[model samples]
Target: MLKVDGLTKKFGELVAVNSLNFEVKEGQIYGIAGPNGAGKSTVYNLITGNYRYEGRIEFDGQDITGLPPYRIAKKGIARTFQVPEIFPSLNVQETIRVGSRFGARGGLDKKHSDEVLNFVGLEEERLQHAGLLNLLGKKKLMVGAALATKPKILMLDEPMAGSNAGEIADLMDLIKKINQQLGITVIIIEHFMKVLTELTETLLIIESGRMICCDRPEIVTSDPRVIESYLGDSYAEDK
Candidate 1:
Protein backbone atom coordinates (compact mmCIF):
# COMPACT_ATOMS: atom_id res chain seq x y z
CA MET A 1 0.00 0.00 0.00
CA LEU A 2 1.09 3.56 -0.72
CA LYS A 3 -0.05 6.90 0.65
CA VAL A 4 0.72 10.34 -0.66
CA ASP A 5 -0.26 13.22 1.58
CA GLY A 6 -0.13 16.89 0.71
CA LEU A 7 2.30 16.20 -2.11
CA THR A 8 3.34 19.46 -3.74
CA LYS A 9 5.94 20.04 -6.42
CA LYS A 10 6.80 23.47 -7.77
CA PHE A 11 9.12 24.38 -10.61
CA GLY A 12 10.04 27.91 -9.49
CA GLU A 13 6.75 29.85 -9.71
CA LEU A 14 4.80 27.15 -11.49
CA VAL A 15 3.09 24.77 -9.09
CA ALA A 16 2.97 21.52 -10.99
CA VAL A 17 1.51 19.36 -8.24
CA ASN A 18 -0.40 21.02 -5.42
CA SER A 19 -1.28 19.32 -2.18
CA LEU A 20 -2.23 16.07 -3.93
CA ASN A 21 -3.31 13.26 -1.63
CA PHE A 22 -4.25 9.68 -2.44
CA GLU A 23 -3.95 6.16 -1.13
CA VAL A 24 -3.42 2.96 -3.11
CA LYS A 25 -4.66 -0.18 -1.44
CA GLU A 26 -2.80 -3.43 -1.83
CA GLY A 27 -3.59 -5.48 -4.94
CA GLN A 28 -5.67 -2.64 -6.35
CA ILE A 29 -5.50 -1.26 -9.86
CA TYR A 30 -5.53 2.51 -9.30
CA GLY A 31 -6.05 4.91 -12.20
CA ILE A 32 -4.81 8.50 -12.61
CA ALA A 33 -5.72 10.82 -15.52
CA GLY A 34 -5.71 14.49 -16.37
CA PRO A 35 -5.02 16.85 -19.22
CA ASN A 36 -1.49 17.32 -20.63
CA GLY A 37 -0.24 19.76 -17.99
CA ALA A 38 -2.09 18.31 -15.06
CA GLY A 39 1.14 17.12 -13.39
CA LYS A 40 0.19 13.46 -13.70
CA SER A 41 3.73 12.49 -14.53
CA THR A 42 5.09 14.79 -11.84
CA VAL A 43 3.17 12.84 -9.25
CA TYR A 44 4.89 9.70 -10.48
CA ASN A 45 8.25 11.46 -10.28
CA LEU A 46 7.54 12.59 -6.77
CA ILE A 47 6.52 9.12 -5.70
CA THR A 48 9.53 7.49 -7.34
CA GLY A 49 11.96 10.12 -5.92
CA ASN A 50 12.85 11.75 -9.22
CA TYR A 51 11.96 15.15 -7.71
CA ARG A 52 12.18 16.67 -4.30
CA TYR A 53 8.88 18.04 -3.08
CA GLU A 54 7.13 19.31 0.05
CA GLY A 55 4.97 16.43 1.11
CA ARG A 56 5.00 12.99 2.60
CA ILE A 57 5.07 9.80 0.53
CA GLU A 58 4.69 6.67 2.56
CA PHE A 59 5.09 3.20 1.11
CA ASP A 60 4.03 0.26 3.20
CA GLY A 61 3.80 2.65 6.17
CA GLN A 62 7.41 3.80 5.82
CA ASP A 63 8.24 7.36 4.88
CA ILE A 64 10.22 7.32 1.63
CA THR A 65 9.84 10.90 0.57
CA GLY A 66 13.45 11.95 0.18
CA LEU A 67 14.91 8.62 -0.84
CA PRO A 68 16.77 8.42 -4.13
CA PRO A 69 15.36 6.59 -7.16
CA TYR A 70 17.53 3.52 -6.76
CA ARG A 71 16.62 3.24 -3.08
CA ILE A 72 12.97 3.54 -4.00
CA ALA A 73 13.32 0.84 -6.63
CA LYS A 74 15.01 -1.40 -4.11
CA LYS A 75 12.05 -0.81 -1.83
CA GLY A 76 9.78 -2.79 -4.16
CA ILE A 77 8.58 -0.03 -6.49
CA ALA A 78 9.23 -0.19 -10.22
CA ARG A 79 8.03 1.98 -13.06
CA THR A 80 7.94 2.17 -16.86
CA PHE A 81 8.15 5.35 -18.83
CA GLN A 82 5.70 6.58 -21.46
CA VAL A 83 8.22 5.63 -24.13
CA PRO A 84 9.91 2.29 -24.19
CA GLU A 85 13.36 2.70 -22.61
CA ILE A 86 15.81 -0.06 -23.34
CA PHE A 87 19.47 -0.67 -24.02
CA PRO A 88 19.82 -0.59 -27.80
CA SER A 89 22.86 -2.84 -28.00
CA LEU A 90 21.78 -5.25 -25.28
CA ASN A 91 19.82 -8.33 -26.17
CA VAL A 92 16.45 -8.92 -24.53
CA GLN A 93 17.84 -11.49 -22.12
CA GLU A 94 20.70 -9.26 -21.11
CA THR A 95 18.37 -6.34 -20.54
CA ILE A 96 16.35 -8.37 -18.06
CA ARG A 97 19.53 -9.66 -16.47
CA VAL A 98 20.55 -6.11 -15.66
CA GLY A 99 17.32 -5.48 -13.85
CA SER A 100 17.79 -8.76 -12.04
CA ARG A 101 21.16 -7.62 -10.79
CA PHE A 102 19.60 -4.56 -9.23
CA GLY A 103 16.30 -6.13 -8.37
CA ALA A 104 14.09 -5.25 -5.47
CA ARG A 105 13.65 -7.69 -2.53
CA GLY A 106 16.24 -10.04 -4.07
CA GLY A 107 19.56 -9.93 -5.85
CA LEU A 108 20.54 -11.32 -9.23
CA ASP A 109 18.37 -14.40 -9.46
CA LYS A 110 18.72 -16.04 -12.86
CA LYS A 111 15.62 -18.18 -12.39
CA HIS A 112 13.55 -15.11 -11.63
CA SER A 113 14.97 -13.32 -14.65
CA ASP A 114 13.93 -16.19 -16.91
CA GLU A 115 10.49 -16.20 -15.33
CA VAL A 116 10.10 -12.48 -15.91
CA LEU A 117 11.08 -12.89 -19.57
CA ASN A 118 8.43 -15.57 -19.90
CA PHE A 119 6.01 -13.53 -17.83
CA VAL A 120 6.19 -10.59 -20.22
CA GLY A 121 5.90 -12.96 -23.20
CA LEU A 122 9.38 -12.17 -24.48
CA GLU A 123 10.98 -15.60 -24.21
CA GLU A 124 11.12 -16.02 -27.98
CA GLU A 125 12.89 -12.70 -28.33
CA ARG A 126 15.26 -13.33 -25.43
CA LEU A 127 18.34 -13.15 -27.58
CA GLN A 128 17.10 -10.51 -30.00
CA HIS A 129 18.39 -6.95 -29.91
CA ALA A 130 16.14 -4.79 -27.77
CA GLY A 131 16.12 -1.85 -30.15
CA LEU A 132 15.09 -4.01 -33.09
CA LEU A 133 11.71 -4.96 -31.65
CA ASN A 134 8.39 -3.63 -32.97
CA LEU A 135 6.16 -1.30 -30.94
CA LEU A 136 4.36 -4.03 -29.03
CA GLY A 137 7.53 -5.99 -28.49
CA LYS A 138 9.31 -2.94 -27.16
CA LYS A 139 6.49 -2.22 -24.78
CA LYS A 140 6.52 -5.79 -23.54
CA LEU A 141 10.28 -5.64 -23.14
CA MET A 142 10.06 -2.51 -21.00
CA VAL A 143 7.40 -4.07 -18.83
CA GLY A 144 9.44 -7.28 -18.66
CA ALA A 145 12.53 -5.41 -17.57
CA ALA A 146 10.55 -3.69 -14.83
CA LEU A 147 9.14 -7.02 -13.73
CA ALA A 148 12.67 -8.34 -13.39
CA THR A 149 13.06 -5.81 -10.58
CA LYS A 150 10.49 -7.82 -8.60
CA PRO A 151 8.40 -4.92 -7.50
CA LYS A 152 5.40 -5.02 -5.22
CA ILE A 153 3.89 -2.02 -6.97
CA LEU A 154 4.13 -1.34 -10.71
CA MET A 155 3.55 2.24 -11.79
CA LEU A 156 2.92 2.53 -15.52
CA ASP A 157 2.81 5.85 -17.33
CA GLU A 158 0.72 5.94 -20.48
CA PRO A 159 1.17 2.31 -21.36
CA MET A 160 -1.51 2.61 -24.04
CA ALA A 161 -0.21 5.80 -25.59
CA GLY A 162 0.79 4.56 -29.04
CA SER A 163 -1.20 1.35 -29.22
CA ASN A 164 -4.08 0.48 -31.52
CA ALA A 165 -7.37 -0.92 -30.19
CA GLY A 166 -6.12 -4.52 -30.27
CA GLU A 167 -2.85 -3.60 -28.63
CA ILE A 168 -4.69 -1.70 -25.92
CA ALA A 169 -6.75 -4.81 -25.28
CA ASP A 170 -3.63 -6.91 -25.06
CA LEU A 171 -2.03 -4.53 -22.61
CA MET A 172 -5.21 -4.55 -20.57
CA ASP A 173 -5.09 -8.34 -20.34
CA LEU A 174 -1.45 -8.23 -19.36
CA ILE A 175 -2.11 -5.66 -16.65
CA LYS A 176 -4.90 -7.82 -15.30
CA LYS A 177 -2.64 -10.84 -15.23
CA ILE A 178 0.05 -8.88 -13.44
CA ASN A 179 -2.39 -7.79 -10.78
CA GLN A 180 -4.52 -10.92 -10.43
CA GLN A 181 -1.90 -13.55 -10.98
CA LEU A 182 1.16 -11.87 -9.57
CA GLY A 183 -0.72 -9.97 -6.84
CA ILE A 184 1.09 -6.75 -7.60
CA THR A 185 -0.56 -3.44 -6.84
CA VAL A 186 -0.86 -1.28 -9.96
CA ILE A 187 -0.99 2.48 -10.39
CA ILE A 188 -1.44 3.52 -13.99
CA ILE A 189 -1.55 6.96 -15.58
CA GLU A 190 -3.50 6.76 -18.84
CA HIS A 191 -5.69 8.86 -21.12
CA PHE A 192 -8.09 6.19 -22.34
CA MET A 193 -11.38 6.40 -20.46
CA LYS A 194 -12.35 2.93 -21.63
CA VAL A 195 -9.15 1.46 -20.23
CA LEU A 196 -9.65 3.14 -16.86
CA THR A 197 -13.32 2.33 -16.59
CA GLU A 198 -12.90 -1.31 -17.54
CA LEU A 199 -9.73 -2.00 -15.58
CA THR A 200 -9.72 0.22 -12.50
CA GLU A 201 -11.77 -0.14 -9.37
CA THR A 202 -10.89 3.37 -8.22
CA LEU A 203 -10.07 6.31 -10.49
CA LEU A 204 -8.37 9.55 -9.50
CA ILE A 205 -8.96 12.51 -11.77
CA ILE A 206 -6.96 15.69 -11.46
CA GLU A 207 -6.95 19.08 -13.14
CA SER A 208 -4.13 21.60 -12.94
CA GLY A 209 -2.42 19.43 -10.29
CA ARG A 210 -5.40 19.23 -7.94
CA MET A 211 -7.86 16.48 -7.22
CA ILE A 212 -11.16 16.75 -9.11
CA CYS A 213 -12.59 13.34 -8.35
CA CYS A 214 -11.53 10.11 -6.69
CA ASP A 215 -14.04 7.29 -6.72
CA ARG A 216 -15.39 4.37 -8.68
CA PRO A 217 -14.98 4.63 -12.44
CA GLU A 218 -18.73 4.82 -12.99
CA ILE A 219 -19.09 7.68 -10.55
CA VAL A 220 -16.03 9.47 -11.90
CA THR A 221 -17.01 9.17 -15.56
CA SER A 222 -20.48 10.55 -14.84
CA ASP A 223 -19.52 13.45 -12.61
CA PRO A 224 -20.42 16.80 -14.16
CA ARG A 225 -17.14 18.43 -13.15
CA VAL A 226 -15.17 15.62 -14.74
CA ILE A 227 -17.15 16.05 -17.97
CA GLU A 228 -16.66 19.81 -17.91
CA SER A 229 -12.97 19.54 -17.20
CA TYR A 230 -11.69 16.59 -19.26
CA LEU A 231 -14.25 14.17 -20.68
CA GLY A 232 -16.20 16.91 -22.51
CA ASP A 233 -19.94 17.58 -22.47
CA SER A 234 -20.62 15.30 -25.43
CA TYR A 235 -19.30 12.27 -23.56
CA ALA A 236 -21.58 13.03 -20.63
CA GLU A 237 -24.54 13.65 -22.95
CA ASP A 238 -23.87 10.37 -24.76
CA LYS A 239 -23.81 8.56 -21.44
Candidate 2:
Protein backbone atom coordinates (compact mmCIF):
# COMPACT_ATOMS: atom_id res chain seq x y z
CA MET A 1 0.00 0.00 0.00
CA LEU A 2 2.97 2.27 0.61
CA LYS A 3 6.42 2.26 -1.00
CA VAL A 4 9.56 4.18 -0.12
CA ASP A 5 12.77 4.24 -2.17
CA GLY A 6 16.12 5.84 -1.57
CA LEU A 7 14.66 7.88 1.26
CA THR A 8 17.21 10.27 2.72
CA LYS A 9 16.72 13.14 5.12
CA LYS A 10 19.66 15.31 6.16
CA PHE A 11 19.82 18.02 8.78
CA GLY A 12 22.96 20.12 8.30
CA GLU A 13 25.94 17.73 8.61
CA LEU A 14 23.98 14.98 10.36
CA VAL A 15 22.25 12.50 8.11
CA ALA A 16 19.20 11.52 10.12
CA VAL A 17 17.77 9.10 7.59
CA ASN A 18 19.93 7.70 4.78
CA SER A 19 18.68 5.94 1.72
CA LEU A 20 16.02 3.97 3.62
CA ASN A 21 13.77 1.83 1.48
CA PHE A 22 10.83 -0.36 2.48
CA GLU A 23 7.28 -1.28 1.59
CA VAL A 24 4.12 -1.75 3.68
CA LYS A 25 1.56 -4.08 2.23
CA GLU A 26 -2.14 -3.44 2.55
CA GLY A 27 -3.87 -4.91 5.63
CA GLN A 28 -0.53 -5.98 7.08
CA ILE A 29 1.05 -5.04 10.36
CA TYR A 30 4.61 -3.84 9.74
CA GLY A 31 7.05 -2.99 12.53
CA ILE A 32 10.21 -0.83 12.62
CA ALA A 33 12.83 -0.93 15.37
CA GLY A 34 16.23 0.59 16.11
CA PRO A 35 18.14 2.21 18.94
CA ASN A 36 17.38 5.74 20.00
CA GLY A 37 18.28 8.51 17.50
CA ALA A 38 18.42 5.95 14.70
CA GLY A 39 16.08 8.12 12.62
CA LYS A 40 13.07 5.91 13.09
CA SER A 41 10.76 8.81 13.83
CA THR A 42 12.42 10.85 11.11
CA VAL A 43 11.23 8.36 8.54
CA TYR A 44 7.66 8.88 9.72
CA ASN A 45 8.18 12.63 9.57
CA LEU A 46 9.25 12.37 5.97
CA ILE A 47 6.43 10.05 4.94
CA THR A 48 3.85 12.34 6.58
CA GLY A 49 5.33 15.29 4.65
CA ASN A 50 6.73 17.03 7.73
CA TYR A 51 10.17 17.27 6.12
CA ARG A 52 11.61 17.83 2.65
CA TYR A 53 13.21 14.53 1.71
CA GLU A 54 15.40 13.30 -1.11
CA GLY A 55 13.49 10.21 -2.13
CA ARG A 56 10.20 8.97 -3.45
CA ILE A 57 7.15 8.03 -1.38
CA GLU A 58 4.24 6.47 -3.19
CA PHE A 59 0.95 5.61 -1.48
CA ASP A 60 -1.62 3.78 -3.51
CA GLY A 61 0.53 4.52 -6.59
CA GLN A 62 0.79 8.30 -6.24
CA ASP A 63 3.93 10.23 -5.26
CA ILE A 64 3.54 12.08 -1.93
CA THR A 65 7.12 13.06 -1.20
CA GLY A 66 6.74 16.82 -1.11
CA LEU A 67 3.10 17.12 -0.20
CA PRO A 68 2.07 19.10 2.89
CA PRO A 69 1.21 17.21 6.08
CA TYR A 70 -2.46 18.04 5.87
CA ARG A 71 -2.57 16.85 2.30
CA ILE A 72 -0.93 13.62 3.29
CA ALA A 73 -3.34 13.09 6.17
CA LYS A 74 -6.20 13.66 3.80
CA LYS A 75 -4.97 10.76 1.67
CA GLY A 76 -5.93 7.97 4.08
CA ILE A 77 -2.74 8.12 6.20
CA ALA A 78 -2.98 8.86 9.91
CA ARG A 79 -0.36 8.80 12.66
CA THR A 80 -0.01 9.06 16.44
CA PHE A 81 3.06 10.54 18.03
CA GLN A 82 5.37 8.84 20.54
CA VAL A 83 3.83 10.96 23.28
CA PRO A 84 0.14 11.15 23.97
CA GLU A 85 -1.37 14.21 22.29
CA ILE A 86 -4.72 15.30 23.62
CA PHE A 87 -6.60 18.47 24.37
CA PRO A 88 -6.29 18.96 28.09
CA SER A 89 -9.38 21.08 28.48
CA LEU A 90 -11.73 19.26 26.16
CA ASN A 91 -13.83 16.33 27.30
CA VAL A 92 -13.19 12.98 25.69
CA GLN A 93 -16.21 13.16 23.43
CA GLU A 94 -15.47 16.75 22.42
CA THR A 95 -11.88 16.00 21.52
CA ILE A 96 -12.98 13.09 19.37
CA ARG A 97 -15.63 15.28 17.79
CA VAL A 98 -12.92 17.73 16.76
CA GLY A 99 -11.08 14.96 14.95
CA SER A 100 -14.26 13.77 13.29
CA ARG A 101 -14.90 17.24 11.95
CA PHE A 102 -11.39 17.96 10.70
CA GLY A 103 -9.87 14.53 10.10
CA ALA A 104 -12.76 12.64 8.57
CA ARG A 105 -12.88 12.62 4.76
CA GLY A 106 -16.50 13.66 4.46
CA GLY A 107 -16.46 15.83 7.57
CA LEU A 108 -18.00 15.43 11.02
CA ASP A 109 -20.21 12.48 11.85
CA LYS A 110 -21.58 12.62 15.40
CA LYS A 111 -22.65 9.01 15.29
CA HIS A 112 -19.19 7.96 14.26
CA SER A 113 -17.60 10.07 16.99
CA ASP A 114 -19.62 8.32 19.68
CA GLU A 115 -18.81 4.96 18.20
CA VAL A 116 -15.09 5.76 18.16
CA LEU A 117 -15.19 6.76 21.81
CA ASN A 118 -16.76 3.41 22.59
CA PHE A 119 -14.29 1.59 20.35
CA VAL A 120 -11.36 3.03 22.29
CA GLY A 121 -12.98 1.94 25.55
CA LEU A 122 -13.51 5.47 26.68
CA GLU A 123 -17.31 5.50 26.60
CA GLU A 124 -17.68 6.11 30.32
CA GLU A 125 -15.12 8.90 30.18
CA ARG A 126 -16.75 10.62 27.22
CA LEU A 127 -17.88 13.54 29.36
CA GLN A 128 -14.78 13.63 31.54
CA HIS A 129 -12.00 16.16 31.00
CA ALA A 130 -9.07 14.79 29.04
CA GLY A 131 -6.55 16.12 31.55
CA LEU A 132 -8.05 14.05 34.33
CA LEU A 133 -7.34 10.74 32.63
CA ASN A 134 -4.39 8.52 33.52
CA LEU A 135 -1.60 7.53 31.17
CA LEU A 136 -3.40 4.58 29.59
CA GLY A 137 -6.58 6.53 29.21
CA LYS A 138 -4.72 9.35 27.50
CA LYS A 139 -3.08 6.90 25.13
CA LYS A 140 -6.45 5.39 24.25
CA LEU A 141 -7.77 8.87 23.58
CA MET A 142 -4.88 9.54 21.23
CA VAL A 143 -5.51 6.37 19.26
CA GLY A 144 -9.23 7.10 19.19
CA ALA A 145 -8.56 10.53 17.73
CA ALA A 146 -6.39 9.00 15.04
CA LEU A 147 -9.12 6.50 14.21
CA ALA A 148 -11.53 9.36 13.93
CA THR A 149 -9.53 10.38 10.88
CA LYS A 150 -10.77 7.28 9.07
CA PRO A 151 -7.32 6.35 7.79
CA LYS A 152 -6.60 3.34 5.64
CA ILE A 153 -3.10 3.10 7.11
CA LEU A 154 -2.36 3.90 10.76
CA MET A 155 1.19 4.57 11.91
CA LEU A 156 1.81 4.29 15.64
CA ASP A 157 5.10 5.51 17.15
CA GLU A 158 5.87 3.80 20.45
CA PRO A 159 2.27 3.27 21.46
CA MET A 160 3.35 1.23 24.44
CA ALA A 161 6.15 3.47 25.60
CA GLY A 162 5.03 4.19 29.16
CA SER A 163 2.56 1.39 29.74
CA ASN A 164 2.77 -1.36 32.29
CA ALA A 165 2.60 -5.02 31.24
CA GLY A 166 -1.16 -5.12 31.59
CA GLU A 167 -1.58 -1.88 29.68
CA ILE A 168 0.74 -3.16 27.00
CA ALA A 169 -1.42 -6.23 26.60
CA ASP A 170 -4.50 -4.07 26.36
CA LEU A 171 -2.94 -1.86 23.71
CA MET A 172 -1.75 -4.91 21.83
CA ASP A 173 -5.27 -6.32 21.80
CA LEU A 174 -6.58 -2.98 20.58
CA ILE A 175 -3.99 -2.89 17.82
CA LYS A 176 -5.00 -6.36 16.73
CA LYS A 177 -8.63 -5.31 16.63
CA ILE A 178 -7.71 -2.28 14.58
CA ASN A 179 -5.90 -4.44 12.08
CA GLN A 180 -7.95 -7.64 12.10
CA GLN A 181 -11.41 -6.39 12.93
CA LEU A 182 -11.32 -2.92 11.39
CA GLY A 183 -9.07 -4.00 8.50
CA ILE A 184 -6.73 -1.02 8.70
CA THR A 185 -3.11 -1.51 7.72
CA VAL A 186 -0.68 -0.85 10.61
CA ILE A 187 2.91 0.32 10.80
CA ILE A 188 4.32 0.37 14.30
CA ILE A 189 7.67 1.63 15.61
CA GLU A 190 8.51 0.09 18.96
CA HIS A 191 11.49 -0.92 21.10
CA PHE A 192 9.91 -4.05 22.55
CA MET A 193 11.04 -7.00 20.46
CA LYS A 194 8.47 -9.46 21.84
CA VAL A 195 5.69 -7.06 20.95
CA LEU A 196 7.03 -6.74 17.43
CA THR A 197 7.47 -10.46 16.93
CA GLU A 198 4.01 -11.26 18.18
CA LEU A 199 2.10 -8.45 16.41
CA THR A 200 3.98 -7.73 13.22
CA GLU A 201 4.13 -10.05 10.26
CA THR A 202 7.26 -8.33 8.88
CA LEU A 203 9.90 -6.37 10.75
CA LEU A 204 12.34 -3.79 9.39
CA ILE A 205 15.48 -3.08 11.39
CA ILE A 206 17.53 0.05 10.78
CA GLU A 207 20.48 1.82 12.37
CA SER A 208 22.10 5.17 11.60
CA GLY A 209 19.25 5.69 9.16
CA ARG A 210 20.13 2.66 7.03
CA MET A 211 18.32 -0.61 6.59
CA ILE A 212 19.99 -3.46 8.47
CA CYS A 213 17.46 -6.13 7.52
CA CYS A 214 13.86 -6.41 6.48
CA ASP A 215 12.24 -9.82 6.86
CA ARG A 216 10.11 -11.95 9.10
CA PRO A 217 10.53 -11.00 12.76
CA GLU A 218 12.15 -14.28 13.75
CA ILE A 219 14.53 -14.18 10.82
CA VAL A 220 15.52 -10.57 11.29
CA THR A 221 16.19 -11.10 15.01
CA SER A 222 18.51 -13.96 14.22
CA ASP A 223 20.51 -12.06 11.59
CA PRO A 224 24.13 -11.73 12.75
CA ARG A 225 24.51 -8.15 11.68
CA VAL A 226 21.18 -7.16 13.14
CA ILE A 227 22.19 -8.64 16.51
CA GLU A 228 25.53 -6.83 16.46
CA SER A 229 24.08 -3.46 15.49
CA TYR A 230 20.72 -3.31 17.24
CA LEU A 231 19.41 -6.46 18.89
CA GLY A 232 22.76 -7.18 20.59
CA ASP A 233 24.35 -10.52 21.48
CA SER A 234 22.09 -10.85 24.54
CA TYR A 235 18.99 -10.96 22.37
CA ALA A 236 20.55 -13.61 20.17
CA GLU A 237 21.58 -15.63 23.24
CA ASP A 238 18.08 -15.31 24.70
CA LYS A 239 16.71 -17.14 21.70
Off by over 4 Å in 2: none
Report the C-alpha displacement of residue 65, candidate 1, in angstroms. 1.3
TM-score of 1: 0.98
For the record, the alpha-carbon RMSD of candidate 2 to the native fold, in angstroms, is 0.8
lDDT of 2 by residue, 83-199 (tens): 888899999999988878767599998898898899999999989999999999999998998899888999999999989999999999999999998999999999999999999
Model 1 misplaced stretches (Cα beyond 4 Å): none
- In every candidate, how many clashes are there? 0, 0
How well does candidate 2 score on lDDT at residue 136?
A: 96
Cα displacement (Å) at residue 232, model 1: 0.4
- Give the true-structure RMSD of model 1: 0.9
lDDT of each: 0.93, 0.93
Give the clash count for model 1. Answer: 0
Model 2 reaches what TM-score against the true structure? 0.98
Tens digit of per-residue lDDT, candidate 1, span 12-75: 9999999999999999999999889999999999898998899999999899989999999999
Per-model TM-score on C-alpha atoms: 0.98, 0.98
